[model samples]
Target: MDSEKRNQNYNTYVEAKVPKTKFWQALLKAFVVGGLICCVGQLFYDLYAYWFPTLSEAQLGSAMLSTIIAITAILTGLGIFDWIGAFAGAGSVIPITGFANSIVSPSMEFKKEGIIFGICVKMFSIAGPVIVCGVVGSVLAGLIYLII
Candidate 1:
């Protein structure tokens, strides 16, 4: 067979093997999972507020963030985050938990190598860019606000 015909035949075979996607079903799953994660964060916020009635709103929010990050890191270490990510898809990715998973996942995976070269190095590989962008963006925003 000529190269053109062979390439066409290969493409056809690959397309045929592709699985059918259920758009609505996936969207529904993502919405539910994402909402649940948010609810959990809210619950922590409420608990913190109740327990520390004198705390400021910002302090309460920080506590909630810490709780969520701890929970996400623990789940990632336990290998449960993978299953959650597989099911939730974008739902999981949109939240802070997903960021926790990104940091913890690589560290856990590379811990076998060593602490300094493996866990520490790999830990920030994924999240480093995000932190950098976030910091730079905030700085730029501050500068713009000051200028205006």
Candidate 2:
């Protein structure tokens, strides 16, 4: 029952087996993943254009972003999006949908723990700095371009 005795029963000498990683596996994952994500966006774009015949191409693109964000957030709320996320992996993580997923996923997960500390902290865990740095980087790049 002692701590030392409990520790002695642990499998300390067990070897860790690494899964076979291959370049082709990764390349295939990226191709299928990236294509699927883009394909879904395309489908949504087409649907929006079909439903709203008056929308311009630019307007359709904006609507697609809004629709993706809304659907991703709703799915996050219902816990269905995570399943799609698991299969899609990087596939579901390249567009505004990914942004919505990133934000909504953490908030939903953390909400079970508590509101303030759990939800708020985890909400900005990954995407916040990315968003911040992206804006700052764009501004810097724009300035440099203007200067030269």
Candidate 3:
């Protein structure tokens, strides 16, 4: 009787728990969200290339970079990119420009707190460690390889 009650309790407990996140759902979200971003980027790339056909491949690449930056800035300014970022965490943030949004959004939040410590300093809090550790590790690895 006790075992039967415990089993019933266990089943009820398990049922009450939140369902685990499925890979397919995440994958689908990533695909749809990320692809939408890439599609827009592709359209802009085509537009820029069409508008400036005389530019060399390197120049075109630079122009693409600038155009993407402009688009991201506009999206960030309009408060849409962050919403997209919230929905598509890795999907949105994997792009180079997403990092720009990540950095800028913090700065925007801290704008009222003054420039040095509030805006500039707080802005890089997330990015700072990534940059610092990356550079330091790269330098250390290079030094070790060079010595060996």
Winner by lDDT = 1
Q: In candidate 3, which residue pairs get closer than 3 Å at backbone N, Cα or C atoms, i.e. clash? A: none
Model 3 agreement with the true structure over 29-90: per-residue lDDT tens digits: 77788888778777867787799888787787677777777777778888988788877767
For model 2, the run of ten residues with the poorest summed lDDT: 10-19
lDDT of 3: 0.80
State which candidate has the highest TM-score. 1
Runs of candidate 3 exceeding 4 Å displacement: 1-19, 133-148
Candidate 2 residue spans exceeding 4 A from truth: 1-17, 112-116
Error of 1 at 132 (Å): 2.2
In angstroms, the error of model 1 at 59 is 0.5
lDDT by residue (tens digit), candidate 1, 91-146: 99889998999999999889998999999999999999999999999999999999
lDDT: the better of candidates 1 and 3? 1
Off by over 4 Å in 1: 1-21
The digit string of per-residue lDDT tens for model 2 on 91-119 reads 67776767888898888778987988899
Prediction 1 TM-score vs. true = 0.84
On lDDT, who's better, 1 or 2?
Answer: 1
lDDT of model 2 at position 32: 86
